[model samples]
Each structure stands twice: as C-alpha cells, then as structure tokens.
Target: MPNEPTASLSPRRLTTLGHSCVLLELAAADGSVRRLILDPGNLTAPLTATVAVDAVLITHPHPDHVDPSQLAALAAGRELPIFGGAGLGSYLSEAGIDAVTELEPGEHEIAGIQVRVGSAPHEVIHPALPLPANLTYEIGGVFAPGDAFARPEGQTEVLLAPTGAPWMKLLETISYVAEVAPQRMVPVHDGGLGPAHRTLHTTVMKKFAPEGTEVSVLAPGQSLEF
Candidate 1:
C-alpha cells in the first residue's frame, strides 16, 4: 500500500533535542502549533525549538531526561501539560507543575494526534534495581522511543530513535528498524555521550540496518521533516 498523505498527518514536526529529548511540534490543520517536550535534556536549536513547546512529555524522572528547573520555568510562564508515568507526575508536582497527566502503556488521543505508549524498560539501567517504566510513543505514525528498542510498527513513516546511553544492543537496534517499517529513521540520544561513544553509535547504525531502511543520523542542531 502507498503511504498516507501529509495532510492526513497532524501538523507535526520532530526535532532531536539533546540526549533523549525530542521536540514534537504539532500544529492544527489550521496552523496553530502545540509543543510537547519529550525528555528534558539540552535540546538542539533551543532558541527556535523551545519557544514552541506547549506540552512536555517526560519518559522517566531521571536527571538527564527530567530537569526540574526547566519544568519549573515552563510551569511558571505557561500552562503546559506534562505527561509521563505516575512516579514522574508526582515528581513534576513537587517541582510545582499544575497540569500533569500520567500515562500507562496504552492508546490515547492528545492534541489531535494518536499516542500509543508501548511497554519498554530501561534495559541497561542496572541488574537488580527496578528500572522505571520506559515508553515508546507513536504520534501520527512516527515512533519516538524515549530510550528503548524502537521497533517501528506498520506504516510508520518516520522514526526518531536513540543511539547513546540506555540504548539497545547493536543487533537489537537493527531488528527494531526492521520491524518498524518506517520510511525514514533518525538516530538520537547522543547529546550526553562522549565523542568516541557517539562515533561508535554512528558506525553501528550505518552498518546494521537491512538494505531497505534509510537512516538519517543527524547532529544536535539538525532537523528532519518526513
């Protein structure tokens, strides 16, 4: 089957902010944009991207993905709905956020976009500790994995995947792409890693994908629109 037209897709653009952060800018068909922050690391092109985030989505309450100060700044200025698991919602409240929503692994509609929170765990966090519930989201057929194996499912036109710490194994990563069936996949989650670690990630993604999947590995400040 042919791909869905852009008009069918909610007016949304995915920008890779730093680390596991992704700026999801969703606009109404009329052109009003709703901004959502997924993970709170230093985002790429902050001056341009940060201005648009109206809602913030934090996958986990970790230091890298959840910055209390940033959330405070947004809450003080605007009424932003912060979405995450139950624990993360509590963490945001203590930080003074008024609008917060707790999401489990299921399906829902937000801002006219279909959001599916899939089951994922921090595979590499630790051996014995109870890893927080990790999430992978599907918005307008684009998969934005918080920090887990992003196996893009059927008809996924774009994929914003991770390539740094909290990443899946190399072979697993390849399998993820194979499953997603997206037209384009961009690598993210390198903002906090060192030069060598970043290099290794790039090399692995370049070598591991099946023949058909196209990987657009971007730097911090770059943008990819599907």
Candidate 2:
C-alpha cells in the first residue's frame, strides 16, 4: 500500500513546561523571533526563568491552568501582556491582577503572532458543579486546546492534546486526534498520572493515532522544533 501523506508540521519551536504549559517561538520575516507562553501554571524552575516570554495566554481560570503567584512573579517588573478568556479576566481582576485582556472567540494578533480563538465546552465533571468556559488557541501553527477537545478554525500543524484529565477518557482522546488530524500531536494535561501511567498513555496513543499523524510525549522541560 502507498504511504499516506502526512500533514505538514509547523516550522515554529515548541517547548513543554510540564502539565499544559507550553512555550512557542516563531520566527518573523525580518529574522526576529516572538516567544509566547501558554498556560504557564505548572512549569518548574530553570525552564520557567529562562524562557523570555513576550506575552502570556491563559485558556481558562482553573487553578491548575492559572497560577496567579507564578504569573505575578513572571510579570513582576515587566510589561507582559496576559490574555485569557472572559471568565479568566474576571477572576484575575477579582484577585487584584488587572493585566489581562479578555479575548472572545475570534482572530487576534499579539506579540507579532496571529492567534485564532475557538470556543469549546469544558467537559462536564459533575452535574451540580458549574463548568468554567474553555478556549482553544491557535497561535501560528500550534494549537493548544486548554481543557477541551476542540477543533480550531484552520489546519493544525502541531496539536497539544489533553491525554489524561478528570473530564477525559482514552477513547475520547483518540477520537479527538482523529478529528483534528494534525501532523504532530503532543500529550498534555497529564500531570496527575504517574510515570508508568504516563508512559502507557503515550504508547497507546502512538499505537492508535491516525495514519500520517505523529504523537510525541515530551518530558518536563523538553522542547521539539518542527
């Protein structure tokens, strides 16, 4: 059988900072580069301090997705722009942090990078509990869908897939990959799993991923250039 054609991966650089946090760097036409941090809620040292972020993008207001102290420390003296969903903006403001821009589902340009926002319902964990709004972000060719199994507007060169969460299942995750059909898929939202479970999830995902799609699980502080 002929090999299936794979989707093209983005030329941008992606670095995983543990959990769902990612650092994305894209080269501009003038040889300059822009660096943006997404969901910097659980990043460890060294990686957290070394990354020179131009802006921060938060997908939701969950504590695991928005560590206020970490963000405050990161933006201590710098004029770092923080963008988040509507609910997140209110949460930050209530906490006395007013540096966040409320972004709805649309296209926006931030820190010289094109960002497209897509709305996706946060998986329901319980009937009584109110689910927070979730937003999926497509920055350049990298798509990070916060806590939702959402499909962005256009082609996804690199997809940050949530593998393990209270609101997700293995089968649903597999289905999401098939639906998005990206060239590359990386596992995120898996901080709660142990090493063995994490490895197992990665192995199973790689085995069942759609043809032409590459699934990679990065260790904390690891980076991959596509």
Candidate number of the best lDDT: 2
lDDT of 1 at 110: 68
lDDT of 2 at 107: 87
Clashing pairs in 1: 35-54, 152-180
- The lDDT for every candidate, in the order shown, is 0.67, 0.80
Off by over 4 Å in 2: 1-11, 42-47
* Model 2 lDDT tens row, 130-184: 9788888988788988888888777788999987888889889999999999999
- How well is each residue in 106-145 modelled by candidate 1, as lDDT tens digits? 8876665567887667767667666777677877657877
Per-prediction RMSD in angstroms?
5.4, 6.4
Residue 43 of model 1 has an lDDT of 41
lDDT of 1 at 90: 71
